[model samples]
Target: MKNILVLCTGNSCRSQMAHGFLNQQLGDQAAIYSAGIETHGLNPGAVATMQRAGLDITSHTSNHVDEYAGIDWDFIITVCDHAYENCPFIPAPNAQRLHHNFYDPSKFEGSEKDTRAAFDKARDEIKAYVTDFASTHF
Candidate 1:
């Protein structure tokens, strides 16, 4: 199985969700993992969004990028633009890196409904990207 890594500023939100979705959708074809440039606890909104999509990430933990050093990856996808630009070396020499930026739902500030909607939108965008990527490249 190919190993894929997803990264973001915080392992809390976007990266976590992407990990959950890819693992679910790709099944045995890929082993997906996620980490952050810096550690932050998993965001509750992120957890909620994944649960709504029928993917459970409640057991997922926010992890630092250092945890992945020395591990070989087939692919390393950055789920946020900033993280993409700042990513460090991956052990896999032939690993294909992709920048697939997604809006950070945690940045949304508004009423509860609006916050939920923002999370949903971000979640859907990531899902769409995953679907397209899987169809074309996985």
Candidate 2:
């Protein structure tokens, strides 16, 4: 199976969502993993948002990029500008690096409804992105 890694500033939101979507889209075609430059733990907003979409990410954990140093990744995807710009050099020389700046719903400050909307929007965008990525590359 191909090894795919989704990255973000914190493994809490965008990357987590993408990880869920990738797992669903690629199924047995690839091994999907998500990590961050720094671990912020799993975001509850992300978990709830994904749960609404019928993807349970509650079991996922926030991980530092260094954790997977030994594995050869087939693809490395950054879901936030911060992670993409500040990401350290990964040794997976042959890995295809892809990037998308997804909004951080965890950073949105608003009423509960608006915050939920933000999470939903990010989740949908991530779902669409991973769907396309999986179809094109897997």
Candidate 3:
């Protein structure tokens, strides 16, 4: 099975959404994990966003990139520039690294509707990318 890791500044939002989408799309075809350069726990907005799309990430946990040091990954994807720029060295010798900055919904603090919209937009973006990634890679 392909081993894939989705990384971001925090394990809270984008990466978590990507992890859920990839896992939902790829199923048993891959082993998926999401981590952060610094763990910021899970984002409720992210969980709710995925739930609206019928994917639940409520059980997911925030993780440090160092946690998966032993796994030989097939892909290492960064969903934000912060993680991409500041990522710690990982021993995934054969992993293909991909980068895409997904908007952070938590940063949008205007109103509940606006925040939800941001999360929804990000969810759609992540889902599209993941569907294509799974189709091409898995």
Candidate 4:
């Protein structure tokens, strides 16, 4: 099974959503994990968005990228630009490093409903990317 790690700046939003999408899409065929350059616990907006999609990430806690040291991953994908810039070094040979920067929905300044819409949009984008990858390769 290919191991995939999703990374973001705070480990609270983008990376966590990517982890849920990958696990949901690929199931046991791919092992998935997520971390951040710095830990900031779970984002409430992120948890709410995932739960709305019928995925529960309540037990998922934020973690630093260093927590993944020595773990071999086939792919390391950064889901946000800040994470791409702050990524930790992974020593796995042949590991493919990729970046697909999605705007942080949490940074959107708007009404409550509007902010939720942004989160939903971001979640859908992640789902599309993951679905394509899983269907073709995993």
Please give each candidate's TM-score: 0.96, 0.98, 0.97, 0.95
Stretches > 4 Å off in candidate 2: none
| Model 1 agreement with the true structure over 59-123: per-residue lDDT tens digits | 99999898988778888899998888877766788788888889999999999999999999999
Which portions of model 1 show Cα errors greater than 4 Å? none
Clashes of 1: 0
* Highest-scoring model, lDDT: 2
Query: What's the distance in Å from true for residue 30, model 3?
Result: 0.4
At residue 24, candidate 3 shows an lDDT of 87
The C-alpha lDDT values of all candidates are 0.90, 0.93, 0.91, 0.89
Clashes (N, CA, C under 3 Å) per candidate: 0, 0, 0, 0
Q: Judging by lDDT, tell me the better candidate of 2 and 4.
A: 2
Best by TM-score: 2
lDDT of 4 by residue, 7-125 (tens): 99999998999899898888889889899999999999999999999999998989888888888889898999888876767787888887899879988999999999999999999
For every candidate in turn, the CA RMSD to the true structure comes to 1.0, 0.7, 0.8, 1.0
List model 2 lDDT by residue over 1-138, tens digit each: 999999999898899999999888889999999999999999999999999999998889899999999899999999999999999999998899999999899999999999999999999999989888977996
